[model samples]
Target: MAFLELHNIHKSYFLGKEEFPVLNGIDLDFELGEFVSILGESGGGKSTLMNIIGGLDRNFEGEVRADGQLLDHKKEKQLDDYRRGTIGYIYQSYNLISHLNIVDNVLVSLNMTNLNNREKKDRAIELLKQVGLGDQLKKHPNQLSGGQKQRVAIARALASNPRVIIADEPTGALDSKNTAEVLEILEKIAAEGKLVITVTHSQDVANYGTRIVRLADGKIEDDTRLKPAYKTTVEQPNVKPKVLSAGASYKNAFQHLSYNFWRNSLIMLGTAIGLFAVLLFSGIGNGVNAFIQDQINSMINPNSITVMKNPAGKKMSTAKFEQSMSQFANDPSKLLLTDKEVNHLQNLKHVDKVEPGYQLSTYTLSYNSKNANGSGFQTWTKAYASDTVKTGHAPKANQIVLDKAQAATLTSTKKYKQLLGKKVKLTLPWIDKNNHPVQVTAELTVVGFTNGGQTGAITGTNYSTMRHLLSNAKADTQANFVSVNVNNSKNVKSVAKKITSIKDNGKYTFGAITVGDMLDTVNQYVSIASIVLAAIAGISLVVSALMIIVTMYMSVSERTKEIGILRALGERKKDIRRLFTAESVLIGLFSAALALVLAYAASLGLNHVLYSIVKFNMVQITPGNIIFTVVAAIAISFIAALLPARKASRLNPIDALSAD
Candidate 1:
């Protein structure tokens, strides 16, 4: 059987609905070691016939049998294998990838092979030597001469040691000297027992072939045999090239993008800065919220629920108030929360402890031969009478614990120790039923000092002496409010609900907020800021994607001849598409890496500024965000490349060569 056979092949095209027949009833055959050349004028359908034979175009009607196996149009992988392993192609325009060196360009054909990198490199160098490009193995395509580039293309075609070498005007772009060099290489390839089929318009190239096929209007018009026979054979080596995984392939693509850093720098930088801005804003907002919550925690026990009077005024009028005494200022019968109410609250589920508290503000006291003003002070005379001294030694009738700021101010006056044990005479501004200043004197012992309170600015006073002084001189009100501490924080809300029910008439309402609630509010606020930031970052991401689209489209246009050359070499449309898409995905991944670096730097700067304002560190970086940024960038890249990839895959080898 003939090594290759085509029986009455027919092909056509659709031109605005009218069928244009390009090839009709064409028959051809070739044998091993035969150097054959096909020659025709432009638009005569010579390139189309080559494309069909090479399996790049399968839509045509044809019966192409190779080595006695009828080529099946339905099985794509079978055709792919045939293209990758059984056929090699040389082109008029060199089709080496600009991003790869000569050796890598050749080795790319063996990417799907099973050989390791060393073996693939060795085989690639051997092929390059055979094509007279041995000295240029380390050079890129753009660094080589036109003839040298064509030689590299020839070496790449022979990298896989295919059974056939298909040449489409392989010397079309070279000078006479380089053409002779390339023609000699083709003649040598055929002499190794392989089928050398070339399509050219030059009679000089045809003169080098052992047999010549002439075509006119897609028909074989003449066949001629030249002088000496060509003999050739290619030894299939035991070693082959190995294929890289998807991840590794993209990594290589990223490396290529990095190598061209200056070209894509602005896009990467812009995207990185945008992402950083978003993260920084979110972090600042979080830090502020955390600081506020901390202030609240230090002043009140997280497990304690404050029971205060819900004033008849606006709901928030008493919301942020200091402990007040009006909630208990009622006749025993009118009060929903009397001593009986306190006993009842102590019995509630999860109730660990309770303290009845009452207070009077803006009182003045004299002590230690010095007078200290208690403006804005809270006096708890009726609440926790003996328990206060039980917790800590009772504040002496002559002693007191000054809030740190208050003590500091008093000490700054150089009268602190003198005032600690001195008699601090009390003077209440409110008059009693007797319409005289309600006054009392107590010797206060300075026990300890406290600086922080609910607003992160309050001073503390021991409850005992303050309460004793209040009881000795009747205050405006008694202990009308209570503070309850629960053992289990989870039960605080439930217990508060039950207590509120007991005072159902709203005469004595109780309200409580948990630390967990504050934490949730802070987190929700931060999350909202994060989403807004992501949206802003998205704008930069979109710009990056557009950059990728523009770059890929330009690449496709500029590499049309390269894609055509690949198609002539038995590379399917899928291969062309994947190559373009791979390049785009690589660009996106590189940008994402750049974005991460910038984000980290920005976080450092942001933390410095935020800590100054809120006095706390707040940027929280998670692995999930890193992964999301990368995935989002890559997905955007892939989507952007779709149109360009499709354009490359749809190119016609004939049209492509004609453009040259």
Candidate 2:
């Protein structure tokens, strides 16, 4: 039994429906320690036979039996293993990966073994030294001479220590002197108990081998035994190729990406800008919402709901009812809350207390001939008691608390404090039931001044004081509006909803408004604006994804031969896909990092510029936002690379190797 047996091999090529036979009825036997040369013309099928024997072209009808086991060419994994562990190929073109150095080129084949990184490196270095290019180990293929490049190719082929060595036109491009040097190396390789098969057109090259088989028109014409075969001193070890792991794939990906750093960086910059815009806008929205919430909290009590007439009914339109309420001083009966309604509100669920308040449409105050016009007056509620009192105390019965602006208007700024305890005459205007103008006057002492920057020209007094004045003037004492206080701030919304559902005789409904409701409305608007802005920013990410797709496709096209080299070196299709996918993920990671840094810097600059106006940081980047940005970047990039990576993984090894 021979080491390798090719039994009646038949192969052909097809152009549309036309078939061109390349190898017809070829039978050959090979053994270890034999240097066999297949001499032929250009179209005599020597290269085709070499390709089949090397496990590169499996589209043929043949029984390739290695050590008595019939090779199943239909199984891709078996073919890959044969190429990785059983055969080594040397091409005339010196098909070396341009980005890798000479030593690294040899290591590309050694990487298929189970050797450690250091061992692989040492093996690659030793192989390069064996080929007489030890000093040029770090030089790229383009930096070497033609002979040197061929030497590197030979070193790479021998790195795996395969049993079969297939050389196609090994010295085709070299001078006589370099050809002799290469021939000597091939003779030595055969002497080491390995099968050396050289395919060539030169008779001088065929004479170097121990046996020569000449082919003419795809048929063997002559077979000659020139010399006895050399036997090895030691037995050859059986070694299998190791599967490429994810870590190894990523390492190769990083090397490729680093070699094209500037191009990848530009793509990353484009993606980072999009991510930065989205993150920055989202942060701004958060900050704006917080600012509005802070302002609302300072202005109103969170646990209080303001109640008003619903002004909506089947007979009357809401607009018409609102108009009537605005003219309440003319027709006080339109929407005034009666005592019965006030008591009903006070007994509702979650109700702590109901404060009845009256607003007289118009009033005037005379303090020592200093006349001050007032819009309306309200009785102090628990909500109002929380206000900051700049001078004196809250208003009691027969006393009034004036706003700071109104107080400043009635006296000099320095004398405003002096007016706190002074007596003032207040006159209330009204239309009598019989359509007559009337006025009610009362003497009240100034009790306090409120920090009323939020509300203007409003006077606060006790409920009993307003009720007494109204009764003295024979006027309606119905409360204009009531404030419903909830037991807990969290219950404000539920309680407010219940209050709004309260109806008087099924004819009139009430309206409920809580500070939380107002804050929610403000936040809702801010959220909408933020979503719109972020969505607009998100368009850039789509464009960035497209850019990545284009870039990956270009990379696949550029590295077509590299893909072939890796496939020939026993890398799996999944390993090829992982290489490209890993590169894309690295790009995404870099983009996310750059975007986060840029967003942080932008937030700093924006906050620094807006701090004086808003008195707060206007941009807030949360941990969730940062994480979301990073994940989004990676997902987008991975999706973008899917098609390109698949294309690379599915490339034909033969076609890729033939590509320029």
Candidate 3:
């Protein structure tokens, strides 16, 4: 039994069912401490035999044995292990990764071992020093001369410390002096009790080895032996190559990404723009909804529901009802709430009070010969008692409240405050059941000033005083709308729903409106608008994802030979996939971080401008939106890279190494 054996190997190639024999039946044996050269011509099958022996080509008829155990080339994992732990290859082209420095090129092989990072670095440095290029360890491949690049290739092959070394035209591209230097190194390697097999066409190169086997037309023509000039000295290490880890894959990904920083940054910027638009729009929607709710709360009591007569059996949407309300604004009779309905609403759950209110479409107010005409008036209810009054008290019986603007018109600016105690006469108009125009008059004291309404000229009067004046003047006194108060603001929604469910004679349903209901409608519209804007923004993300896919595929094409180098160095397909995926995730993370910063800055500027007018922050970016943006970015990038990464991982090492 020998250290390595090839028993009666037979191999051939086929061109569409036509057999073209490459290697004829040949038997060979190899052992430690032997420098063997398979010298041959261009089509003599020397390289093909070396490929089979090096575990790179498995499609052949052969019985390969290492230390008497058969090498099964059909098992991919076994072939991978054999290539990683048993053989090292040196190519004529140097085949160095251009992006990595000299030290990193060697480390790319050494990383497959279980050695720690410091140990790997030290080993790489020591190997580079052995090839007499220690000072150039930090330089990239393009910075090196032809001889120096070959030296780096030799150093990289030796870094993994395999048992057998295979050199295919290793010195083919070098001058005589450099060729002699490379041969000397190979002789020394064989002297250290390791198998050194060199495949070459030069007889001068073959003479350096202890044995020469000449091949002519795929058959062995001669086998000759010579006296060796060197002896064994160094001992081989008992280390085995370990699987690459996820952390190492990511580290390699970061290195590759950093090498092309500007290109990757542009992709990140495109993705960040989309994420920023989505986040900013979502924040603005949230803020706008909040602002509307605040305004509603300030203007009307949250615990109050406005009740109106529903003329139809079916309910209408808020938008449709609002349109109808505007169209029927002049016909107050269509929206009148009967006295029986008010009594029914007062009997409902959570109902603390029901105040029937009259809305006089047109009215006039007179005080001390200063009269304001075409003024609107409403009966003051408990729900409007607090915020509507700026001074004095809410209107009761013969008392009335006027807004500050209206009071200012009836008196001098200095006397407007004093007008709170003055007596004012109100004239109201309505049509009776007989369709006749009627005017109602009442004299009342100015009790308070209203904070808001249709206009400051509008006045608030007691429901009782308006009803009494209408009765004396033979005018209809049916309430236009009623206010139903609940015990708690939180129950407003449920209470309003109950009020709408209330029906008269099983035909006429009542419509109930609370601050929450109106706010919900407003928020629904805002949410739809936000989603539309965000979707429009998402188109950029889709485009960015396509950019990432194109970039990854380009990277794969650019690094095809590097991929072969890694695959020959024992990296698994999954490791290759993970490497590319990690780079994409890093791009996504960078985009998300940039988008978050931009969104925050935009929010600050927008809120500053909006606050000057509405006194409110109108762009609120929440934590949930930030988190969603980041997650969405990462997911999109990862999905986009899947196909390219898989294509990269599936590349054949032989085909990739052979690519120009």
lDDT of each: 0.67, 0.84, 0.84
What global local distance difference test value does model 3 have?
Answer: 0.84
lDDT by residue for model 1 (382-483), tens: 222232221134244445555544554555545544444433345544333343446554445555444453343332344555556656677433344577
Candidate 3 lDDT tens digits, 269-379: 998999999999999988988887776666567788888777664567655655666654666677776777778887888889899988777787787788777555778
- Candidate 1 achieves a global lDDT of 0.67
Off by over 4 Å in 2: 67-69, 191-193, 223-240, 303-516
Best-fitting candidate, measured by TM-score?
3
Clashes of each: 27, 0, 0
Question: Per-candidate RMSD vs. true structure?
Answer: 6.0, 5.2, 4.5
Error of 3 at 575 (Å): 3.1
